[model samples]
Target: MFATRSEAGDRLAAELEGRGVEADVVLGIPRGALPVARPVADALEADLDVVVARKLGAPNNPELALGAVASDGSVWYNDALIDRLDVSDDYLEEIRAEEAQNAREKADRYRDSPGLPDLEGERVLVVDDGVATGATATACLRQVRAADADYVGLAVPVGSPQSVADLEAEADEVIALETPENFRAVGQFYREFGQVTDEEAIAYLEGLGGRS
Candidate 1:
């Protein structure tokens, strides 16, 4: 288990370098990922930025994500979950619209702009604390692709075996330090998994603190 997100980032960065992976840009999903992405950007000698997305929760079960939507309105839906839940198109549209705005606001907070940076012809890597259902990661990957990135990849410290396999179809490359079949949640593998406030999260971008 990772002692801290910073430690996870260091190991993840080393793994990426060991594999000779090159990234022109490293985009972290904000709040939890900034701490993880900082070292990766420094190691790769790439620019670091935020890629924001919000999960669309199931009706009356806000903790259950049916999908996620990016700041640019790019979305990834879990058809299996939606189908099993028997969710209607009307409910999906309603929640997507609401969450899309939330994602844009979050992106604006991170970058002081509403959309992603120009990634055309750039090698883009999306970093997160870890993958669960991979709903948000997929949305951000689609957003990067829509921006015409030359290459898109995802790297994480740990993830569920199933989610890692599913994300293969979403990016050019996928790397995980650990993918246990018995994984339950991303927090299970972390020794210090605390909720990151916006101020602390933005500090990673400002270069104030991250290694802690």
Candidate 2:
């Protein structure tokens, strides 16, 4: 098992070598994804950037993510989750507006201009630590796709097999170190999994040569 995010990224980068993926850049979905993408960007010898997305939490139970919204208003929702939770369209719009604002704020804090990156003809490696329900990652993938990237690859150290399968339809390529069938949560595999603050995550990206 990898000792830390950097080590996990190093191993992941080695795995991504020469899959016809001429990496023009690496973008991490903060706050946890930034550290994981740093070493990969270094290994790929490409520019590093940051992508921010926020979970659109349920109105009553804010801990549960009904969907996610990226900085640019890109959203990916779990229809099943919303149905199960009985979330209404009006409530969803309210939550989406609040969460989208938070996402934009974080994006602003991380970059000079939090607007989507220029990916017209570039191949980007999007890194995240892991995926649980994949709602957030799916939203992120949509935002990246909207940028018109020449090629997009989704890379994570660990994710549920089903989550990986779900994301494959959204990305050109999907890479993961482990896809355990019984995966319950991403934190179950990490020993040092902790909350990453916006400031610290931005600092990590800045150290990796990240720019808006």
Candidate 3:
């Protein structure tokens, strides 16, 4: 288990180097992932940025995700789960719209502007602290694709085997340090999975400008 997010980021960055992965930019899914992504950007010598996506929680169990929407309105829906849960289209649309706007506002706040980085023809690496359901990661991947990134990759310190397998289809390459067979939750793998405040997350992004 990683002692801290920074340690996980360092290991993930080392893994990417061993795999010969190179990126023009690294986009971290805030606010937990920013700490992890900072070390990755430093290691790869790439520009760091935020890729905002918010999970659309279930009506009854808000902790459970129905889907997710990115800042650019790119969405990833769990159709089977939604159908099984008998969620209505109207309800889904309502949550999707709300979450999309939330994601947009978050992206704007992190960037300090509405403008996103130019990713056309550039290799993009999308980093997250870890993947559980992978709903948000899917949305973020779609958003990166929408930006016309020449290559889109995913990097995480650890993940469930199923989630890692599923993400292989979405990203050009996926670098997961560990995929435990009996994974319960993302936090289970980390010794110190503390919450990252918005100010702390923003500072990581702001520091990237000096590197570029």
Ranking of predictions according to lDDT? 1, 3, 2
TM-score of 2: 0.92
Candidate 2 — worst ten consecutive residues by lDDT sum? 203-212
Among all candidates shown, the one with the greatest lDDT: 1
Q: What TM-score does prediction 3 earn?
A: 0.96
Overall lDDT per candidate, in order of appearance: 0.94, 0.83, 0.91
Residue 164 of candidate 2: its Cα lDDT?
96
| RMSD to native, candidate 3 | 2.5
lDDT tens string, model 1, 19-93? 999999999999899899999999999999999899999999999999999989999999999999999999999
Comparing 2 with 3 on lDDT, the higher-scoring candidate is 3
Best by TM-score: 1
| Residue pairs in candidate 2 whose N, alpha carbon or C atoms collide under 3 angstroms | none
In candidate 2, what are the lDDT values of residues 1-212, reduced to their tens digit? 45666667777778877554558889899888877888788778878888778898887788788989988899988899899888899999988888889888878887787587798888988899888888888888888889999888899999999989999999999999999888998878777777777776767777732321
* Candidate 1 segments whose C-alpha is farther than 4 A from its true place: none
lDDT (10s digit) by residue, model 3, range 101-126: 99998888888568469999999999
TM-score of each: 0.98, 0.92, 0.96
